[model samples]
Target: MDEQTAGALPVFVFPGSIDVIFTQPHTHKQLVTLYNPYEFPISYRVLCTAPKKYSVIEPRGTLKAKCCVDIVIRHLGANIRSNIGVPDRFRFEVCKYGYTEVSGRKDIAVRLVENASDIARQASLDQSNFHASFPPDGSSRLSPPQYAFPSNPGAPSSQSSPWLAVVAALACIGALMLPTQGDMMPSLLPTYLHLSVPQKLVAAYVLGIVTMLIIRPT
Candidate 1:
């Protein structure tokens, strides 16, 4: 949807993003979806940063459509519960009409400190957190508006970036076609073989494009 062509007034609402850290009972991952209301075009940036220090980790990149955006963060191999001592915070930066105007600048913060004891005691998993809020100053800071990741980690990693599927498939194919240890043919009949490298990549690109084409709130 073109922001310029969208309805007169602008409306935006997001349930917020998920943060997962691998550890303890299981691996965890979080996904956030957003709905956009505007008549002009827009570019959205989803960022997950260290709450205490924003620069510790730069904001990760993800694509957003004119009407909505989704963000996913994965906590890998280690128990997510381990991070109970640490808090995770995130921010969203949106540039619309090629930055001519900005819309829906928001932040989603998670508190691991308060919920740590419960997580360790029950060994229970929680995915609940705070309500999403907007910050007057884009800078990250401690405040009541912040939220916490409620559950221990559950997933190893966020799904690979949709854009990488194609390149990854091609890379795997090229690797397989090349000779391997002991001159092995590298299982040419592997299930992945059914999806040729180029074909797989093309399919991925199509899926991503289609996903954007059908962008809508869930």
Candidate 2:
């Protein structure tokens, strides 16, 4: 599969990167969503560049028409100080339900951040890369224009730089990954993971501003 080339895959992936916090207990996991926007079912597999460093759940599966699958990827390596700042990546390959050949490919970076502020700064930067593009049928779990990717990235005459569908997706991923009111699921997430309604609202509002900054004209 690594030697194959693929055409446009109708699947959508979120966050653009999978970020795991480096800490003790090492229980935090990142969620990567694979969405099938087409009417037909699709088969997909996830591949990692650094296989020994992480573990993925549902690495291969079939997504029914207009459905999405959430992949749970956890950092499995020890917290090695020497590995900080290095990058890891995951590749997604998709094909029609019955086929073994690849139809399309998507890749996402993986980062292990040492602290909370690094995560915040990364999220802020991620939010400024939006351009809103919806699929043909217009049914989207995320109402924010399929995460707002610009239509063109190669047109020299265009004013706005076309980026991958992200920022908004990453912001939403952050919100989704935040722990809810439950002790059953233990995590390495910071103690301040809890948020009130107003606090959540402010977070959303701030993220909205970040999205505007990227989509807006310079």
Candidate 3:
């Protein structure tokens, strides 16, 4: 253990720089180990200045004295295409807490490199990976109807229409009266209950649309 005295405060020194290589396709996963040489346990945080493309595991954690922790680096396939020829530079800043006087900061630069052949191979692999991760089944795949809006010529003007506001206000009044109004409820309940499940569902959906249109700011 190497000890350095910084203005009377004794600091335990450890080796800092760690180099990591991430080859395309085959070697997408890489691990970095950080060792603490101090007698007491220390808390540390690992930070990177990369975009959402990179997934880092165990970036921040506590390390026991004289023990080491492994940080996993996974390159997301979505962001890898943008960093084909150029190296994706990630500066890892490991800062130690507890000791305010001593600046226990370690800076490590991890470079993600890929050759032309590797990039080509990874692209195909990424496509396959994406498909495998999200299977084209009803459970995993989202239907277009879930996200798509109704294609109506009158939709653009509906927002400004006073009729839409009236319909929305009626829907709100109906919703509020359904639970409280006893005499009107019996007649209305039978109308809703007499309809098939699908028809009731459509009615409920239309009511939701009306409610949304009413709440939406003009």
The stretch of ten residues in a row with the least summed lDDT in candidate 3 is 1-10
Q: How does model 3 score by TM-score?
A: 0.39
lDDT by residue (1-57, candidate 2, tens digit) is 322223566447886666766663343467889999999999987766556556666
Best by lDDT: 2
lDDT of 3 by residue, 1-218 (tens): 22111122232223232222344344455566777777667665444334344456665566787788876655553234455433333332223556532244333333344553454544444433333322222122322221222223123321246576667667655554443323343464644434444544555677777777766774
Error of 2 at 28 (Å): 3.4
TM-score of each: 0.39, 0.50, 0.39
lDDT of 1 by residue, 35-145 (tens): 555555566544444422222111323234546555444444224345664545555555554553445566555434333344442222322322223234443442311
TM-score of 2: 0.50
Task: Show the colliding residue pairs in model 3.
Answer: none
For candidate 1, the lDDT comes to 0.42
Q: Which is superior by lDDT, 1 or 3?
A: 3
Off by over 4 Å in 2: 1-6, 24-27, 119-218
Report how far residue 139 has shifted in candidate 2, in Å: 32
Candidate scoring better on TM-score of 2 and 3: 2
Error of 2 at 164 (Å): 44
